[model samples]
Target: MAGLACAGQLAAAGHRPLVLDKGRGIGGRMATRRVEIAGQACGFDHGAQYFTIRDPEFRMALSPLADAIAPWDDGGSEPRFVGRPGMSSLPKAMAEGIDLRQGVEVLALRRDGSAWLLETKGGLVMARHLVMTMPAPQAARLLGRDHPLVPRLDCVRMAPCLTLMAAFPGAAPRPFLHHSSGTDPLAWIAQDSSKPGRHAGLTCWVAQADPDWSAGHLEEAPDSLVRLMLPLLAKTIGAEPEMALHASAHRWRYARVTTPLGTPCLADEDGTLWLGGDWCLGARVEAAWQSGTALAKALTRHLHAG
Candidate 1:
């Protein structure tokens, strides 16, 4: 979503931009998957549950996709929105006219004269300015040697989260329940199929483990971790899930931002390189969008000054 927004603003200002992601598809964390059982398909948004818009600029920027995305439980009051069909649709909508390259991981970034060179698995590309929207640790790894933003990067911290999705053969014991632990491995648990989708008879559950738990078991086997988490989910939901059609574990090494920078954005020494992500502001979709917009404005100013 950040890449798409950045590319959109840059293109609107008459600058061509290329967006690349290491994942198989766009929408870094706003991910969705199709779980098939008995020749029936069910959509599940296993990543982010919902996104909230706190800033006016972000709300205005998202207004175009507002119809495609609707506010969740309008009477609640907090401005939370979900994709009309699913969360992934929001990012797909934003990437409408941009040149996007998926499944391309960036290997390294180096400065050459007045231009920035990005080395990816595919090849190398040169850009007058470089905008990085990855997590602090990942971004630091990409920019090997010391740079202006390296010092500040040390202050950034990320939390890990593990989401477990299970499909049952029959109806769930309970309709829906959101569970959280005060200080346990379990953080949040939700029924996936319960949230605006088909496959009602087949129960789907998502369990997000706390940061400490995820960090400790990051290297453990996927099956082992799932076994440890299944009981907690079963107890919370009041029944044991039967016939696990699909049980998968996702380790989000950079799931949440613990300490965010005070500023909404940051620029490199040469003004040609800028950094932005959820960590710059807060850990939410809105923060990501705001960071991208701020970087775009800063880049526009830098380009005009040149």
Candidate 2:
């Protein structure tokens, strides 16, 4: 969300900003997992379930993507929105005119006089300005402990998440669209098939563990996690685990931000290296967009001034 937002704005400004991502697709945590079961194609939004439109800029920015976005009405106090078809649709749409290269991971980063040199999987690439939108912990590891920016990221704390994606026959009981509990191990569960624009051939559910439970079982194997989480989900939805057509688990090491940096972004004294993400503000898609937009605006202003 942050990377694409930053790159999209920079591209609109007529600056050819390049975005490199290690994942096979865009939308880091706002992801969708697609699968085929019994000749039925289904998808689960295993990452960000839904996003809110609190920021005016974010709401206006989504106007152009109104077709791809939909109101989710999760029965919450406030209105919520989600991307049509899947959560990744929003970022995929935002990346249309931008230069985004997937499956390219940066192994290391260094400053070469006026440019930033990046050692990637393919080869070394240089850039006049660098913007890192990865998780703070990951950015710290990549920049090393000796870097001056590493300490600033120390105040940012992110939590892990363990999610379960399961599917049953279409005849399965339809309990609720969404459920959340503060004490339950299965913190949040949603009837993903109930979302707009989803395939109706199967009943799909997405369950996410709370931060405390996720942290405790972060290192457990995926299959073992399925064994543990599936039963909880089945009990909640009044279904049997044996009736599941497909079941799987996904782990997000840095899923939610517990403590934020209290700033939109971090930058070097020379205005060359900038770091920002959802951790810069809070644990929301709007926050990531804000951080990325702020970084891009600051970087653009610095470049023009130089």
Candidate 3:
């Protein structure tokens, strides 16, 4: 969300920006997965469930994706929007005709005179300006322990999350579309299939464990997590565990931003190098977008390139 938002505005200003991610697709935490279960294809929004646009500018920015997004009833006090087909749909729409390379990771970053030299598996990518949208810990890894952002990021605490994606055949018990309670080990659960444009014949559910539980079991195997989580889900949804056609687990090491930097962004003295993400503000798709937008505008002003 952060990277795409920045690149979009920068591109519109006549500057070409190249976006790269190690994942197979865009949208970062706004991720979705597809798996074949019992001869049927099922999708799960395993990452961010939905997003709320509190900023008028952010809402206006979503105009292009009005058709792909709709309100999600996540049992929240306020309404939120989710992408149709999957949560990644909105980002996939933003990336249309944009220079984005997936399945690529930056191994290291080095300062080369006035440019930032990025070392990737392919080769070195040098840029006069650089914007890093990764989590604080990952960015600190790339920059090393001596960088100024380390101590500040050390204060910005992020939590791990263990999510379960389970699918059952027709007639699976679904008492509600979504449920969340801070007291439970399974902090939140949603009938993913209840959302629009999903597989109708099957019941798909996504459950996220609380931060404490996720932290305690962060190193456990994915299959083990699934084995432990499915029964809890079955018990909660009034469904039979044996009826599940597909069950899987996804671990997010940096899932939620609990303690943020309390700033919109961080830029080098020259404004050529900027680091921003949801960690800069609060943990939300909106915060990530806001940080990236603010930093991009600052970059354009400092460099005067767009």
Ranking by lDDT: 2, 3, 1
**Which candidate should be chosen as best, given lDDT against the real structure?**
2
Prediction RMSDs, each to the true structure: 2.1, 1.2, 1.7
What lDDT is reached at residue 217 by model 1?
Answer: 89
User: Tens digit of lDDT per residue, candidate 1, span 166-236?
Assistant: 77677765446465658757788766665553358687778889888889888888888788887777777
The residue-by-residue lDDT of candidate 2 on 119-205, one tens digit each, is 998999899999999999999999999999999898899999999999989755545564566677998889888888988888999
**Superposition error at 54 for model 3 (Å):** 1.1
lDDT of each: 0.78, 0.91, 0.88
Superposition error at 299 for model 3 (Å): 0.6
Candidate 1 lowest-lDDT run of ten: 67-76
- TM, every model: 0.92, 0.97, 0.95
| CA deviation > 4 Å runs, candidate 2 | 171-175, 178-182
Off by over 4 Å in 3: 74-76, 171-183
In model 3, how large is the Cα lDDT of residue 291? 92
Clashing pairs in 2: none
Overlapping backbone residue pairs in candidate 2 total 0
Stretches of model 1 off by over 4 angstroms after superposition: 74-77, 170-177, 197-201
